[model samples]
Target: MANTPGAKKAARKIARRTEVNKARRSRVRTYLRRFEEALSAGDAAAAKTAFVEAQSELMRAVSKGVVHKNTGARKVSRLAAALKKLGGSAA
Candidate 1:
């Protein structure tokens, strides 16, 4: 319950930011899932492609303050490692 006018405005701002962040989060997840699926399918070409796109999207999210820089770096690192291992196992 927001009794004061400023408190009500703050609540509204929070709601708006939540919606924006939710969309950003969902977008990042979708990109990550695409990369995972490509990796699971053992398609190096597709996985690499997906990885590049996902990396770009992740960095964008980081620049927009939607995700932390270290978080994005870790995600990209893990995905790249998985992709590399996928090729190694196939060889």
Candidate 2:
């Protein structure tokens, strides 16, 4: 359906961008999951570290336009609160 040269190029770009965005989103999910698992396991240190790393990864997603800025901020806030509670009790 993409007959024109510009259209063909645009289609290719879209395909490549889609694949990149998918990978980025998956990576962000992996980081978030790590934090969750650590928190659930009651590993305060691990959970704190994971939360920091996940926050960075999430901010990167926002920068890449894969996620909204406020969404990232909200997720980070919730996760940090979880980490705080876990760490506080464990300490």
Candidate 3:
């Protein structure tokens, strides 16, 4: 219960931020899923494209504070490794 006016406003702000963050997280996940699907399908070109998009989205999320910097880097690294293992150069 937010009794104080400031507290109520803070709660509202938090709710709005939560929604935005959730959307950003979902977007990142969607990009990641696309990359995974491309990889699994063994489409080198599509996988490369998806990897770039996923890495971009992840970095954007990290910059927006939706994800930690190290975490984002780690995920990108793993994705690159997977792409490499799939015979694609993650340039």
Candidate 4:
């Protein structure tokens, strides 16, 4: 429904960006789910490893503007807390 050429190009750009963002979001969720699974399995070592990876991915998302800075920080904080409760270090 774009009337102008510029509008059509903008729509295409938006569609591409949306696809990229969705992929990024799904990647983050996959990492988070892995972390949660490790936690539920009662494997401190595995959970720590997953937490590290998930935290890195989350921060990367924030840097890419896919996630808000505060939101990423909050998710990391909560995950760290859960990791700690599992007798794992936040490192």
Candidate 5:
């Protein structure tokens, strides 16, 4: 409950930010899922492409503060490992 005008405004801002962050997270997940699907399907070429795009999306999310820096780095590392296992160079 926001009793003051400033508090009410802050609450509204928080709500909007929450929605935006939620959408950003969901979009990041979608990009990761694309890479996962390609990896699981054993399509090295497709997985490589998806991994590149997902890496970009993940780093963007980190830059936007939607995700922590270390978390994003770890995710990128794991995906790169998986890509490497698929006989592709994770550039």
Candidate 6:
């Protein structure tokens, strides 16, 4: 319970920010899922495209403070590795 006006305003701002961050997180997850599906299906081209989109979304989330910088980097790294593996297998 926020008693003071400033506290109340902060609470409201936090609530709004939470909703926005949630949406961003969900969007990132969706992109990641798409990438995973493409990878698992052995479609190197589609996986590469999805990987790019997922990396973009992940970095955007990191820039927006929805995710930590290191976590984003790690995820992007792993996704790239997986994409590389897929490419290797197809070729």
Each candidate's number of clashing pairs is 0, 0, 0, 0, 0, 0
The candidate scoring highest on lDDT is 3
TM-score of each: 0.89, 0.91, 0.99, 0.97, 0.98, 0.94
Q: Which regions of candidate 2 deviate over 4 angstroms? A: 88-91
Q: Estimate, for each residue in 1-91, the C-alpha lDDT of model 4 and write its tens digit.
A: 9999999999999999999999999999999999999999999999999999999999999999999999999999999999999899996
lDDT of candidate 5 over 1-91, digit per residue (tens): 9999999999999999999999999999999999999999999999999999999999999999999999999999999999999988898
| lDDT of each residue in 29-68, candidate 1, tens digit only | 9999998899888788888888888988999999989999
List per-prediction Cα lDDT, in the order shown: 0.86, 0.90, 0.99, 0.98, 0.97, 0.92
Query: Weakest 10 consecutive residues, lDDT, candidate 1?
Result: 82-91
For model 6, how does the per-residue alpha-carbon lDDT over 1-91 read when each residue is reduced to its tens digit? 9999999999999999999999999999999999999999998989988988999999999999999999999999999989888773322
| Residue-level lDDT for 82 in candidate 1 | 88
Which wins on TM-score, candidate 1 or candidate 2?
2
What is the C-alpha lDDT profile of model 3 across 6-85, one tens digit per residue?
99999999999999999999999999999999999999999999999999999999999999999999999999999999
Q: C-alpha displacement of 61 in model 4, angstroms?
A: 0.6
Sorted on TM-score, highest at the top, how do the candidates line up? 3, 5, 4, 6, 2, 1
Tell me the deviation in Å of residue 14 in model 1: 0.8
What's the lDDT for residue 12 in model 2?
A: 99
**66: Cα error in model 6, Å:** 0.5
Q: Once superposed on the true structure, which residue ranges of model 1 sit more than 4 Å away at CA? A: 88-91
User: Global CA lDDT of candidate 5, please?
Assistant: 0.97
| lDDT of prediction 6 | 0.92
